[model samples]
Target: MKSRRPKIVVIGGGTGLPVILSNLRDQDVDITAVVTVADDGGSSGIIRHYVNVVPPGDIRNVMVALAEIPGIYKDLFQYRFETTDDFFAGHAIGNLIIAALSEMKGGIFDAVQELSQLMRVNGHIYPAANEPLELHAQFADGTTLRGEAEITAAHKLIKRVWVETSNHHAQPRAAQPVIDAIMDADQIVLGPGSLFTSILPNLMISSVGKAVRESPAEVVYICNIMTQKGETENFTDADHVRVLNEHLGANFIDTVLVNTGKVPDKYIDYQRWDEMSQPVKHDFQGLRSQGCRVISTDFLQLRDNGAFHNGQEVVHELLNLIGQPRFQKDSRG
Candidate 1:
């Protein structure tokens, strides 16, 4: 009999979670994706506003990431309506499927599970909350922003982010499985995704944060390759770690993965000058001082269209970290 594969839990939302999952699925690890549900833009926003369901963008991405179907099924699900008309324009087919299922099951979580079974996903995916909740941000300048879309457009420095309801309850199903996965996991990975929007949103949930802080699994963070324009305009690798620690509390992560490769000057120029984005400067020494073991490597993958990390190079690096003796050593020392 083959040996049992290690159980892995990835926590985040949007494009990043799916990218990570797509790679991990190939490695035969038992994977569980805990997705953020605070999205309030485009098709997801319309559904949430009208029918009152959890945002489905992140969940849809995870489904596509874990999809075992071949040919048109994948293509069809990912297809988007392109039109100038407001009714159907910009809507994704998968988003509609999730909405339909939610209506049938009368709950988004149950609907997601049902769809996961149908998609023949390698593992599981879940929303961070059951009830649709808005994300609220308090800026440093004393301005408060409501809704995820509005917060992103604030174009100002964010002091902190929280759920709209002070008494908001966690979807019991979401918290229980995630806690169980964390407790039994060999490794727990954070992100190579958006810092504030993707990663921190999940961590801000009270139950999720409590479970992560108490789990024995080695928590690894894959720092982003570039700074997001609106969110992390000038953040460095150390700055990213600092904000995460601040939000999740001290000593949250055990290891940090930083990209050490040279980005092509053309790509850098296109991103910086053209896109108004900047490369994330690696601060290895600064990160090490925070009681986390630092692992640096050339983890960049150039795509056909000149995109970076087109595949799962970052995910492989994360798996390699889990096997290292240094990662096994307790950070509390």
Candidate 2:
């Protein structure tokens, strides 16, 4: 008889979640993606504004990543409108489908599940909340920004972020599954995404934070290769963990994976001159002092199109971490 595969819950939203999920799909692990619902841009924004639905872009990305469908279906789902019109341009077909399903099912979570089934997704994808959420950011300069778009475009240092409504609640339907997944999970992985916006937002959910703090699963954090321009302008690995622990409380993460290789000079020059983004400095000692172990490796693999991370290399590192003897030990220590 074969041993059962480990259950894993990946928490984040947007491009990063899908990349991680896509790499893990063929592995012997059961995956659950808990996506942040604070997105208010493009097609997602349109649907949220018009119908009061949680933006489905991240969930749609995960769905496509985990989908076992053929090439044609994948291409069709990923197709976006290329017109110059303000009404329909830049809208994703999958986003519209998910929005329509949410309208039919009366909520975004149900719509996601319905779409997952239709797409033949190998695992589950859930929104962090049922109600539409506005992402509000308090900048270091005492300036406040509302909505995801404005926050991303602020170009200022963000002090903190929170949901708009005090009465905002995690979709109990979404929380229950997350809790269940955590209880059954052997490991939980956080990011390779934006530290403040993508990764931290999910952990900010009251129920989700409680579940993570109390879960018995070992938590792994994949630190970003480069600092994001507006979000993590000058953030180091230690800074990332510090903010995460501050938001989710102390002793939240177990292991942090850092990229150890030197970035190509050409890319570094391009980033400095073109993108104006800096490299994320890894401070292993700083992270270790905060009760988390550091795992360093050459995890960066940039493509011709400027995309980073060779999927197989990341999967190899993740699998190595999972197979470690330390991984079986108590994460609380």
Candidate 3:
């Protein structure tokens, strides 16, 4: 009998998730992306304010990443209007498409699944929640901020983060399909995105967090290459893992992918990419203390004077891990 494809669930938002998904699409595996809906920035924020739907910018990009359609179709979907356009200015065509579909379908979850079939997406794209979620962060200075944009712009060290409904009455929850995806996953991956804003917002969802903690899959974290000025300035790799563990109230991460590459400082254009501070410092001992197996290597790709993971390299490692004896034993048992 033919074996079932390995089911991999990637959880996070921002640019990193799509980059990794686009590469994983080429491999023979079942991919499910659990995207964060806590965005309140740029086009997404604008749409959220007016349309009152889960931000579609991240979901739209994830669609393109896993889409098995023509390049022209993808291009048309991703096309963004110029700021000069008054009515629909600064919004991607895909975002508007998702918004329209959400309204037609009466919810974001159903709309994404419908669009996923239309786009011929290789796998599933599940929003971390059905409704729009507000990200609330408490800074180390004892001040609290609401909205993902406000929290990141505060540039203060974050103490912790949680999500709430727009009215702050109901607790946010994931769709049953999302929880089932986590429960059935052969491997689960988190972040190559913002530590607090991009990654945590999804996990902070009570159901999603509980499912992740209790899931049997080997949890992997693709540690960021550079520390962000607002989110993780002067942060070590271990610090990132610690924050994740503390928020979930469990030391659950099983493996961490760290970049041991040297980034040339002068190559970074501070003027353009001001959000990034520097390379994430490594602490092998701290990672071990958290009960994580560290995979350190040269996973860097330098382009546009910015540091990023070479997605092919990262996916190669992921496939290798899935084939290992330990993973086979854990997954089969």
Q: Output the number of the lDDT-best candidate.
A: 3
Q: Which prediction has more favorable TM-score, 1 or 2?
A: 2
Task: Report backbone clashes per prediction.
Answer: 0, 0, 0
Among these predictions, the greatest TM-score belongs to: 3
lDDT of 2 by residue, 1-333 (tens): 988888888999867778889999999888988898888887888877887888878888889999999979998898888887667798888888988898899988888888888889998887877767778889999999888888988789988887654244543334478777766777888987877778877877777887887777788888888888788878889888888888766667888888877776655555433423767887888898778889888877766525355667777777777666553334453
Which scores higher on lDDT, 1 or 2? 2
Deviating ranges (above 4 Å) for candidate 1: 84-86, 165-173, 268-276, 304-307, 327-330
The order of the candidates by TM-score, greatest first, is: 3, 2, 1
Clashing pairs in 1: none
Per-residue lDDT for 1-333 in model 3, tens only? 999999999999999999899999989999999999999999999999999999999999999999999999999999999989999899999999999999999999999999999999999999999899999999998999999989888999999999999988899989999999999998999979998999999999999999998888889999999999889999999999999999998888888999988999699988888888999999999998888888999999999988899999999889988866433223221
lDDT of 1 by residue, 55-122 (tens): 88788888988989985898888888898857879888998899889999987888998999998989
Flag regions of model 2 displaced more than 4 Å: 84-87, 165-174, 268-276, 305-307, 327-333
* Model 2 lowest lDDT segment of ten: 165-174
Please report the TM-score between candidate 2 and the true structure. 0.91
Query: How high is the lDDT of residue 1 in model 3?
Result: 100
TM-score of 1: 0.91
What is the C-alpha local distance difference test score of candidate 2?
0.79
